[model samples]
Target: MTNTIIEFKNVTKQYDNDSPVLDHVSFEIERGKFYTLLGPSGCGKTTILRLIAGFTEASVGDIYFDGKKMNDVPANKRQVNTVFQDYALFPHLNVFENVAFGLRIKKLKESVIKQKVQEALTFVNLAGYENREIREMSGGQRQRVAIARAIVNEPEVILLDEPLSALDLKLRTEMQYELRELQRRLGITFIFVTHDQEEALAMSDEIFVLNRGKIQQSGTPIDIYDEPINRFVADFIGESNIVEGRMIEDYLVEFVGGRFECVDQGLNPNEAVEIVIRPEDLEITTKERGKLKVKVDSQLFRGVHYEISCYDEDQNEWLVHSTKKANVGDEIGLYFDPEAIHVMRFGESEADFDRRLEAYDHGDAHEQ
Candidate 1:
């Protein structure tokens, strides 16, 4: 059976005399999935997390948990726990006491609190460190402690607000794997907030990309990365070579003073559009054997591949990642298959974008 753990309906949050921090945001989170609210700072990622955790009430609209309205639910009454960026463990308390804090507040039996705390600590792989003070733990260890404390309460959902942002790169990467594994083993919903695209793409079952208090897109990582809805999404998710173009027909597009075949449809004839081609999708070859000819402006060795920058006759810059080496000022040809091209409309909402994609897919299926 499908289970939706959280739902937001036209949620808007505002402060006095200020613009709304979250503007009519609406989405749903299914049970036992890892979801990432991804965006830059002040993009409402944290705001959504706060709303879910009941840290703050939405200024307008309904919030629901498990088919129940939660607009007036207090943080303590909600079936969710939060792990903050700072860890938030009591400095004076040992790991055991910290993990047992919530259980103790409920006046649970000491035996019950002890068992729950031990289980939570073991789940986080901190089994033997229960007696250690919070100050004695490393950053990653303390993070695990915070997670342990939250899990001990046995909440149905865990909200993490940039919890790994304070760790060093190596530790952060390690914890990312550990956290994902923990969530899988626990079989509870996890809602993580972050501005780091790599973190979101690497860990999330689904990602909601936000900007300016609005969600630009929400899909699996591969979907958002490979088929961004607009220039903002394309640029923010990863490196993309975007250029203005016109849709000549269902399968034809025009750009860089040349007409090319693409694999997109459902656009008005001669409609202005933008084309996105990832750097890794382009292949470098001899001018006569290539689809687009350009002069190489520069190249950078990026370990896996060389990032080559080239400009066409129309002075449109194209970035390509290729294993082949090319010198500056060298005239080279770039080749790409029709399927590598992604066409995007300007200011298209996610709903409209999905409809267009559905139509395109339907058309393809009918032809077959």
Candidate 2:
């Protein structure tokens, strides 16, 4: 028996000859795992959520649930519920009525509806606020009410469409923890959509990073951050210092008039490539002890660390995160381990990229 709860087989969502919202997307979601669709606006993350929720249909390919095709399933017929970005609660109804609305529509017994609504609200820490009007609830409270309503239906899967986008930072962070815990306790699949990279990293067990109607990459947050497939995935996931480079041979790359040792292999000799070095991986030292010399152009104190900007001799910008202060206009040396270098090709497919990474991780690439 397989554990797959949901699957998209070559799904593409296009509209009226406009560019496709989703382009031949395929993925599987295991039961009880938290998955995030992460991307920028109009990149099709929300469209994916809509498709899964049955609010919209895929223009091509099939969607499956537990190996059964669900292309014809209507929104209300699917065993899934959605929490929208706007909270979508009824202003005229109090908390109890709002949460009980779904049950009432089904003509469920009042006793059963009451019991379910109570449990749902209490689980979301909204106990004893049954009579509170939607207008009276704070933004966070309204969000809780919305969630309570979704859970009241006993959904097998929940689709959260940027539900935390409206809350202030502190509340949003709190909700991240709360939502994660809720998913754990319920043991149901959660498909969340968000463009916030930090939110996706903090919450998702797996992430699908999307761009321009296509899935650029999908993996664990750590995997995406540590071994991004290309410049787009690397730059979109977080800040990086990417520079043009050339592969001199196996494990040697030349960049900025300097040759350095790296772990990557199996590329053509003298192949052009891109190098990604993370800001936090950079260590600042005296010029004499550094592998690269750069002049500090500016520095800003960012509470947790100083975000320093510098320029090398070739005028390429390098960003560094450090706790130690460096005066602007001062020349400094930057040191990074050989393993810090992540080499990328110009146009690598996800399959080839994953294969290459797996080769390196399993000691196969080293043999090349």
The TM-score values for the models, in the order shown, are: 0.93, 0.94
lDDT of 2 by residue, 223-292 (tens): 8888887788899998999999998998999999999999888778988899999999999999999888
lDDT values for all models: 0.90, 0.90
- Model 2, residue 340: distance off in Å is 1.5
- Show the colliding residue pairs in model 2: none
In model 2, where do residues sit more than 4 Å from their true spots? 347-368
- Candidate 2 minimal-lDDT segment of 10 residues: 359-368
lDDT of 2 at 101: 97
What TM-score should be assigned to candidate 1?
0.93
Model 1 stretches with alpha carbons more than 4 Å out: 347-368
lDDT of 1 at 164: 98
Candidate 1 per-residue C-alpha lDDT over 1-368 given as tens digits, one digit per residue, 9 for 90 to 100:
44998999989999997999998877889999999999989999999999888889899999999999999988889999999999888998999999999998999999998899999988999999989988899999999999999999989999999999999999999999999999999999999999999999999999999998988777889988988877888999989999999999999999888899998887789988999999999999999988899999999999999999999998989999999999999998999999899988756667875565445333432221
